[model samples]
Target: MSVARKVVIEITSDNVCPWCYIGKKRLDKAIARAPSNLSFDVRFRPFQLDPTASPYGVPKLEAYERKFGADRVEKMIPHMKAVGEAEGIKFDYGGLIANTLDSHRLLAFAASQNKQLPVSAALFAAYFENQQNIGDRETLIEIAAKAGLDADAARAYIESDAGEREVREEVAGARQRGISGVPFFRIDGLYEISGAQDPAVFEEVFAKIAESA
Candidate 1:
């Protein structure tokens, strides 16, 4: 029997990033294609693409256009749409907004419990699919429950100050590492994949790690 490989992949992302969604989808597809003997672990770290963003949410396209220039934003739309279509995901650009600090906290809590991957995926679905506010406590609890977590405990964690420091620390660490964008995937804590890349990229990385292990 093959020994289950121990691989730790970390991602620093926020809920509102369009490319982050695409990155996740691509990673999921890559993982699905990975060898069955390859067992690994994944964690979601904290990084606010816009740490200064208001809790009420800034305009999605407008914000991107302003930050990266209107021309670049205009160019990004078609690419983003294509990626979403490839992954069978709908790009709800208009519906994307929110601070995501609370979401980060919940992720940290889930990470502490070794449930970060599923919880983070569920939180993304809640925001992008269900058009729900991931920052809302009730919404987070529901999402956590859907991810196989305890809704009541998630609710309590959101209500309490628990895991806030860890979330902040993760954000600070990302900043210290010079991460300014979402969907930054760190493979085996060494190889870094940034933005919404093709599944082939993740496949290559996953294969390399599996071989190394």
Candidate 2:
């Protein structure tokens, strides 16, 4: 018999969403536990949790308060810190912001070259760990290069609005699917999982997909 076709996983997430980051880590771990013979293609889609964010980062603390309310964010910090520790991911929540639209566009550019996941990871590291303003064109290009994209060409593309249409299309697709949050995962383009869950959760999902094939 012919081997089963690989599944495509569509992830709709904003880089600024900490849960999205954690969710990706969990998904990675889950995929690691799946059947070796099975194959899958992961695609990160665009979702702007905060569409009104300015190009320049807003003050991290204030921005969080505005997005989720002061009390709620304050209560969540300790939990986020603990989760970060568990995942070996840093929580510089102090320096990040709510702007990720341009970051999404840059990911689209990277996707055009089949380098979306690496570029997206770099973008996440730049903003969350390195505390860089990922929305900045220069910064985004640099991250894109680190993710194996051609830096000069990426810079040019970002500056010339060459990938804007593709970015918009992805955003529209997300909207059409009724995705309002980050880290949304559609496994094999069929099974859907939302939220930044545990690595075990991803493993369970991966097994299900593999078995079904």
Which portions of model 2 show Cα errors greater than 4 Å? 1-5, 96-98
How close to the true structure is residue 71 of candidate 1, measured as C-alpha lDDT?
Answer: 93
Tell me the TM-score of model 2. Answer: 0.91
Model 1, range 92-168, lDDT digits (tens) per residue? 66654668888888888887777888887787777766667776677788888889888888888899988777777
Candidates in order, TM-scores: namely 0.86, 0.91
Best by TM-score: 2
Lowest-lDDT window of 10 residues in candidate 1? Answer: 89-98
Alpha carbon lDDT at 143, candidate 2: 87
Flag clash pairs in model 2.
30-203
